[model samples]
Target: MKIQIEKEKLQAAYKNACGCVKDAFEKLFGEDVLETAKPTLDDYKTIKSYEDACDVLGLSPILSENRNKALCAQFPDHYDFRQNMPKHIIALMKLEIISRALWGKSFEPEPDAEGNKIYWYPWFALYTKDEVDRMSDEERKSLCGALFGGAGHGAYAGFGYLTADGRSSDSGADIGIRLCQETEEKAAYFGRQFIELWAEYLAYGFKVTEHLK
Candidate 1:
């Protein structure tokens, strides 16, 4: 004779299963942490393998043998979760939040009518040189806050380059209000903000830094 499981017991088991899955993901991916690495436009393109890219960026792979084993052992019911989920989902999420917070825009992926993926373009990479020059210094500073702010800020900036043509500051003003928020407590907040904004102008292939002064 087969024994029937109680409803409460089934619910508890399901909750435990989800917790185990989440814990397994954390252990396998190491909390989805971001690291800063200064990659030139070429470096971003040269790497053909994810392992190579991870090495260049000093990022550990979210799916390794040991991490996978830990996940499988902890969450037997959902051992295939990592494989089923796209690896870039976390990176995309981080980028989405940062992009929206800084640019007031979203990074939309280009797709065909059939819903097949085509390309991903960051909002900044689409800017014209004239547009970059037209933007105020305050706006540029916010986009490039990583250059002046801490490592986390730099990581965010580096991640921005993952999208097509992300290296060009001309498309999107890097500096503005976010930089102010990032360094509000510093004594030279205003000065640093200006400095960061100026750097972005220079990076955007500008000839006259004095235009803003």
Candidate 2:
């Protein structure tokens, strides 16, 4: 709900999270992708708290119903309500979760990290599927191109490692999930922690200011 954390602390935490995601990306893919993606505090800070971050980037509250309709019409063979859907929709959803974890909430599992009740954002599940029978090859290829640009291959392929279902993975679709998870989780953890640490830092700043007064 309401964040009691200080702004400066949150900012620092968010930055650290971004760095972690960036590092992961560099490790899995290469520095080239990170250089192009260039995820930053300003890009993530727009998403306020964990919940808001989750809803906006994780779930993608931005694209309206009309947009979906248009996408479906334009790519009829690839866009299937029952199957393919739009790639952007899925991308937005994954982004929201990453944002939530980094900016809004902490990663908490019921029993701990190894628990079955490990609640993950939606995109993690989506990328694990086999062929989207609903969409045509052209549609899938186009969606991949649009979402990933030049860095799509390695990122998409990396999802096979992240997901449980390795055999049924799509390179284009999985890359979005991999990148989002890498970025958002770090941002959320650091943002919340930074706030707590900043409170102490501010107390010292206040004392110094008060002495001057």
Candidate 3:
């Protein structure tokens, strides 16, 4: 459940994965939708590590907290921006939705899917249908939960809407399993592979798949 891998590999791999998703996004969605995510990929150049990612996700929690009323009395300026989620975060959100769409599962989100403060946990579990179907729910939970122990900046472990509470109304494994494989498109291969490699590494480190029932 612990890791010693260099943050550089994770940083590079995440950007590559984002790039691949962006390519798919352009093909499936439109340039307008793609605009939100474009800046995030470029952000990788300077925001190059787990700590950096945490900071980025922490952009303005107040805007989203307490039904857009967290510490609002102190900062009236954020009132406008807090009306909706930040554009870049929405872009990342769309990326995840697109991953689900590839599997014929559509998402009509309504402030669901608590944002990942750690970033990687959301995308790191990307897996082809066969690849993830091979994993049981508990296995998937452990793998995604591997990073739960990370501290600071209000970081929590596990993927899905579950992070907001003790239970997962959405299935993390369902999201993890549905990816490129469903499309049968060649472009999906590398993206899927990059995700797969990191998944295996995390699984190894966390021992999630070592003893599956």
Q: For all the candidates, what are their Cα RMSDs to the real structure?
A: 20.5, 22.9, 17.2
Task: List model 1 lDDT by residue over 1-213, tens digit each.
Answer: 977766434433443455677566446434423122332223322232333344444544444223545446655554333444543443333222332232212323321334233222222233456866887899877755733465332333221223353543423223222322222232132223233333332354433344332
Better of 1 and 2 by TM-score: 2
Q: How accurate is candidate 2 locally (lDDT)?
A: 0.40
| RMSD, candidate 2, Å | 22.9
TM-score of each: 0.18, 0.18, 0.19
lDDT of 2 at 20: 70
Query: In terms of lDDT, which candidate is stronger, 1 or 2?
Result: 2
lDDT score of residue 23 within candidate 3 = 71
* Worst ten in a row by lDDT for model 2: 204-213
How high a TM-score does candidate 2 get? 0.18
Q: Candidate 3, residues 24-125: lDDT per residue as tens digits?
A: 755754555433232132223333222233344443322444432324665666554534764445434433433333322232222326553322233333
Backbone clashes (count) for model 2: 17
